[model samples]
Target: MIRGLYTAASGLVAEMARTDVISNNLANVNTSGFKKDRAIFRAFPEMNIHRIGDPAVLSPKDKIDPKPFIGVLGTGSMLDEINTNFSQGSIKNTSNPLDLALTGEGFFEVQTPGGVRYTRDGSFTRNQQGYLVTGDGHYVLGLNGPIQLPDGKDISINRRGEVFSDGSFVDRLLVAAFADQRQLLKEGDNLYVSNQQPLPSNSEVIQGALEGSNVNPISEMVDLITAFRAYEASQRVVKANDDTLGKAVNDIARL
Candidate 1:
């Protein structure tokens, strides 16, 4: 009975973590360049049940097998990891020349408080210093460094992520790719850091466009419902175990 209670409690905790991931995906359905998170779980090792009884002295010729192969049992499960899906999102055109979007695998370089960071959010703007920056004022890096636009000249980002003004090349955007994307760590605020080997650039930029969030609302809703049901079932199991324990102690044991 006690084991059953612990198993149900573990299930409840795992379901709660799944619920959090689903809710976060739903909440970021409209966020630009946002990736969805998935919850992974693994079962814990099973406990060994051994028989306890008095044993008499055995004869010299008699022998007994101390260990026998019992059926495998699961104690419980826990959240193993949270995986990030880097699938491309749909692009929307805003017609703003400074806005850019990557059509393939890549990440835009941005100067953040924690040094250089990477992002897929290409929605950029010119700051007061005439420098291209993200919506949150992170400086956008280019081949030569931070890209600075010319005054009163219309800025255009070509398919090669080159910044041009009056048909003259000003700077090229620094786009980077990872050989192993799973090694990248999410630092929040639409930024990621990677320690894996960098891959050759293969992404093209499209000006006047923005990448949409990768979250699918319909899928997230379905996941939310499943998590809720699982949590509820675990709660029922816990309640049932409690009732059985109560009866055993107060009624059966008393009788």
Candidate 2:
């Protein structure tokens, strides 16, 4: 009975973790260049019912007589990992010269307060210094360093991610990729830092657009409902176990 209670409790915890991931995904559904995360679970090691807490059960009854094997019973499960989904999101055209997006696999490099960071958010603007920067003022790194746009000039970027003004090449945007994308750690506000994988230089960039979040609202809503149901079921099991324990101690013991 105690083991059963623990099993149910584990399930509840796992469901809670699942719910958290789903909620985060739903909240970021409209965030540009946002990638959804997923929760992974692994079952606990099984317990042998016949040999549980009994050393005497290990002895063979007879050499010829077969002792039927009892199947292993599950203890429970838990959240093993939370993995980021790197799949590309849909693109939205902003018609702004500063706004950019990646058509293929890549990330735009930025000089954040914490140092160099990576992001998919391409909503950029020219700062007072004529430097191309994110909406939050992070400098956008380019092949020649921070890109500086000429005042009142029509800017255009090609599929190759090169910025041109008055048909003259100004600078090329930096699009980076990771060999092991999973090693990247989230640093909040959609920025990522990666030390496990070196940045790859082959990714292409697209200008005049921004990548939408990869979150799927319908799927997340369904998962949220499932997590809630699982949590409720676990709550019921815990309550039932408590009631049973109470009855054994109070009512039955008194009788």
Which is the leading candidate under lDDT? Answer: 1
Candidate 2: stretches off by over 4 Å: 51-69
The digit string of per-residue lDDT tens for model 2 on 1-255 reads 788799999999999999999999999999889999999999999976442332434457623323344678999999999999989899898887788888667888899888889998898899999999987888999998888999888899988788999889999888888888888888878888987554666656667788999999999999999999989998999899988988889999887
Q: lDDT by residue for model 1 over 18-41, one digit each (tens)? A: 999899889989888888999999
**Model 1, runs deviating above 4 Å:** 48-70
Measured by TM-score, the strongest candidate is: 1
**Tell me, what's the RMSD of every candidate?**
2.7, 3.3
C-alpha TM-score for every candidate? 0.90, 0.89
